[model samples]
Target chain A: MTTAAVTGIGVVAPNGLGVADYWSAVLRGQPAIGPIPDSTYPVRFAGQVVGFEPDRHLPGRLVPQTDRMTQFAIAAADWAVQDAKLDLSGFDPLDVGVVTAGTSGGFSFGQRELANLCHRGPEHVSAYMSFAWFYAVNSGQISIRHDLRGPTGVLVADQAGGLDALAQARRKVRQGTRLVLTGGLDCPLCPYSLTAQLAGGRLSDRDDPATAYLPFDVRAGGHVPGEGGAILVLEDRAQAGARGAAVYGEIAGYGATTDPHPDSGRPPNLRRAIELALADAGLHPADVAVVFADAAAVPELDQAEARALAEVFGPHGVPVTAPKTAIGRIYAGGGPLDVVAALLALRERVIPPTVNVARRTVDRAVDLVEAPRPLTGSAALVLARGVGGFNSALVVSTRDIVDR
Target chain B: MDAFTLAELIRIMRECAGEDDQVDLDGDVAEVDFAELGYDSLALLETAGRLAREWGVSLPEEELTQVRTPAGYVALVNRELAQSGAGG
Candidate 1:
């Protein structure tokens, strides 16, 4: 089976704009969640990427009209491309592809444009409003900006879309594409955007900053919204090895399922998703040393996830944690962010802290990492579930990690 | 204006348009078309919505669209409020 190795990673999150800053903030357990100060829209809290001006990273000519989401993906993709040290002088454009996942594309732009259209008339709207909010704008922009001509696609599996994108990118590699840039980007923090999220009923509305979000705890109330994006430079491991490229971790497994409605009981879909990802990697449950559980922070949601883990890992005692709790959830970007955390954890032999969580676990039998702890491991599995029944898991192995 | 109390309702008009748009009451500011000052359609809508939120009144869509300038908007809002008998 063909393997996909993440050679480069780039990120833009509320906690930090770049991957290094993001990682450091997560390690230090920085809490970036707070009340939304913008008076235009009403939402209690959001994870906003402050001080991010899309123009600086974007070509001047294209700056005025691109959606914020596309700007994020392009910026992150550019970083990943640079980090991979790809000599684009002779890189085959047709052999490269772009795949991205987004929760809501160009939402802020859409809200603003709609506000304008409602007030000023049809002629007052910008020409770019039409394409900016479309979900596939990230993939389209990245492919256009980078000159990637192979396969291009977008997934809307909510948060799991990140891992689903990796799976699709891997499948593309097996089908013949040599290089693929894949990841997820989302910033659903705008007032109009946040109000839509408020309609979901699962959103955490804790006015108190301290007790606002608590995932996978006995007092788990609900999850908070955060904005950010993560993109990985994925290439054929064999091709990378031939060129002596820096390899981070191999995409060994991916599982995905849907639970549609929480009232239906924890459906069997997520367990099947986990099993498929394991089967794809030709590995059993025992092969995983650490489990990056999706700490959604909603009491019922977290409980359902716990039930899924119990069914899959039963008595194995694999360590589980949700590092995202430190920086709030980044919607579609959550799964890939967890993937990056998993890769780093496997590399450093240490699991990142799940901040703001009480040391007590809902299920004490499971080895949950509340605080940062060191673990000797060769492989790790990251699990994530999205609202409206999207679930995905990925297994990344450190069989090829090397210092660059 | 005291810091403790809310700023005047007309203050929103200046704040939304940037520093150069602030004007004295009864000045030509009310008559100036928003587009003439580069206040695009979206900006006008956002401004009106902000005004509605601040004044605690629902500005009907018809009245909102009829007011294309800052003064027109403020007058329309005052008229709608007076008709509802909420304020003078």
Candidate 2:
């Protein structure tokens, strides 16, 4: 079976800007959630990517042409390509593709342009605004930068979009694409986007960062909105081996499903998605070493996720962790970041903690790791749930598992 | 009031989009194509937007599209300035 192997990973999270930095911080259980600087919004706390200077990472010309989200994406993609040690000249440009996910596309840039339009009329608006605020602009800009001409696309399943984007990249790899740059990054901390998020009523309004986003805990209120995410390089396993690329893990299986209508009196299908993903990978639930949880940090939503995991892995059957508790929920970026964390856990033989949840306040049948725990399993399960009923699950396992 | 000079236009162009290392803005670049100087239509539009806000000279989109060089952009902006009684 042809599988998509993760050859490189790039992260621009609030906790860390690169894979090494992020992995260290996650292992240390350092929390990055803090006050949203220079803001007066009710939900003032979030995971902002402080100290990210685009001028240092990107060319000056691209600064004005992109939004913060796209800037992060570009930087992450460039780093991923570098990490993969990929030479674009060797492969036909048509065989390389880009697939990414975005939720609140370029809100800061759009807000600035809208302010200009309101104060100075239509002529004051920037010509770049036409593409800068687009959700698919990340993929377009990355493709244009790398000259990737094959099977590029953008997924918009909110948080689940990150995993869905990787799934799309896997499909592209299976379809004969030599390489794909995939994952997601998001920056929705601006007033315009925050207002939209506030309307959703899922963001925690607490001023305290430590207790603001405790998933599955009795004190669980809601999640804090955050900025930044990760990008990954996915190459065909054989192609990666031929190129002597260092493999992180294989994107072994994927399954996605939408929940039934709220009025249908039916249960959420998160369990089915997990089961399907395991089946796709030809593994039983017991084969999964650990689970990277969605960890919505909302009581009912957390309950639903817990219920799903219990149904599949049984009560306290499998270890689960929500490392995102350290960085808050980053919408589309959160899932890919989780995938990166899972891959690192499998590679390093340690599971990073779900920081700040000292006690399991809720009666969820899953064991939440609060500290760095030694990993003994070869495969990991990553699950993501988007707003409006999008559920996605992906299985990533070591190369030996793939060989088997 | 001051006339928008090619030097000023070049400075603004550089500010809007970084100058290409291959092209020296300090040289005789008044008649050089903006594209050759690494400035695109969007950069020029941004430069024009800045001029409108700072100098109260709004270059129409049609006229702006006709500008292809620093000298042309300076001339168009000065013309708009003269019409608006903001020219030197």
Candidate 3:
């Protein structure tokens, strides 16, 4: 089987804009969740990507056409391409593709246009609103900007969409596409979207940022909404080797399962997704070095995830971490960002700590890495769950594992 | 009853779609094609929408699409303003 190697990574997380800044902040367990600036919504706190000047990253024309989400995607994609040192001129445009996950299409843009409709008239809306607010706009905009004419798509499974997008990109690369830009970036921290999120009854209503989103903690309530995510370059392992691109890791395997109806009496099948991902990677339960948890933060959800992990890996069998506790749940962006963290963890040979989580309050069945710890294994598993019962698990391994 | 001048059109164009560095909008660009000026159909639509809001003259979509140059767009807006009895 052709393995897809991650050659480059770009991140625009709330705590940090670029890969270096994000990684440093994650390692330090710095929390970026705070009061949503200038927001009138009842949901007061969220992880906003402050200091992002779209004019600095994108051409002026693109700034108006895109929502903040797409702007983050374009900027991150540009960085990923640059990091890979892959010249578009060197490959046929049709050979390169883009796949991304998006949750809310441009909420800020839609809110403005809807305000126009309510106040002035329909004529007051910007023409860009037609495509700007569509869920697939991120993938479309990235493909148009980079002229990636090959397979292009966007998955909309909420948080799990990011890993699914990456899994799709891996399939595309294995199917002989020269290269694929995959992952997700989402910015839903606007009044309209915040109202929608609040209606879901899943967001943490706590005013204090420090205790707002405590995943896996005994005091777990709910997650804080957040903006921004990551984009990565995935190329065929042989092609990446030929180009001498730095390999971060190999996208070894992916598995996704949907939960049964809540009233159906069947338990959530997250364990099946994890087991399937490990099996697809030809890995044993003991092979995974670390588990990047979904960390929904809601007590029941957290307990369910903990139960799944404990069932699969045995009681405190493997190291588990939820670095997202620092940045909040960024919807679709959460999964890809977790994947980036996993790859970085594998590279650095250390597990980043899950902040704001008390060890004594954590589930005794799962060994939550509340502090940075040395990693002695070669593989990592990333898990994500969407609101509507979407469960996805992906296994990424050191490139040496693929080589051997 | 204010006339839509070339200066006003240039301002609206820049406000709707950012200026292209390669195209000199500050020079004699009245008769230049909007395509050459780097303002595509969507940019022109946004500019038209702004004009309707600021000038209170609704330019028809068909008439707006027929405009190929900034001068033509200015004339179209002025004609709409006159027909609506809002222009001198």
lDDT of 1 at A250: 88
Task: Give, for candidate 3 chain A, the lowest lDDT window spanning 10 residues.
Answer: A395-404
Candidate RMSDs in order: 10.4, 2.4, 2.2
Quote each prediction's TM-score. 0.79, 0.94, 0.94
DockQ-superior candidate, 1 or 3:
3
Report the lDDT tens digits of candidate 2 across residue range A162-239: 999999999999988989999999999989999999899998887788989988999898999889999999988888
Residue ranges of candidate 2 with Cα displaced over 4 Å = A401-404, B18-32, B55-68, B75-86
For model 3, what is the alpha-carbon lDDT of residue B21? 63
Q: lDDT tens digits, residues A156-219, model 3?
A: 9999999999999999999999899999999888878988988999988777888888887777
* lDDT, model 3, position A270: 95
Mark the regions of model 3 whose C-alpha exceeds 4 Å error after superposition. A38-42, A359-362, A401-404, B1-3, B78-85
- After best superposition, candidate 1 residue B28: deviation in angstroms? 39
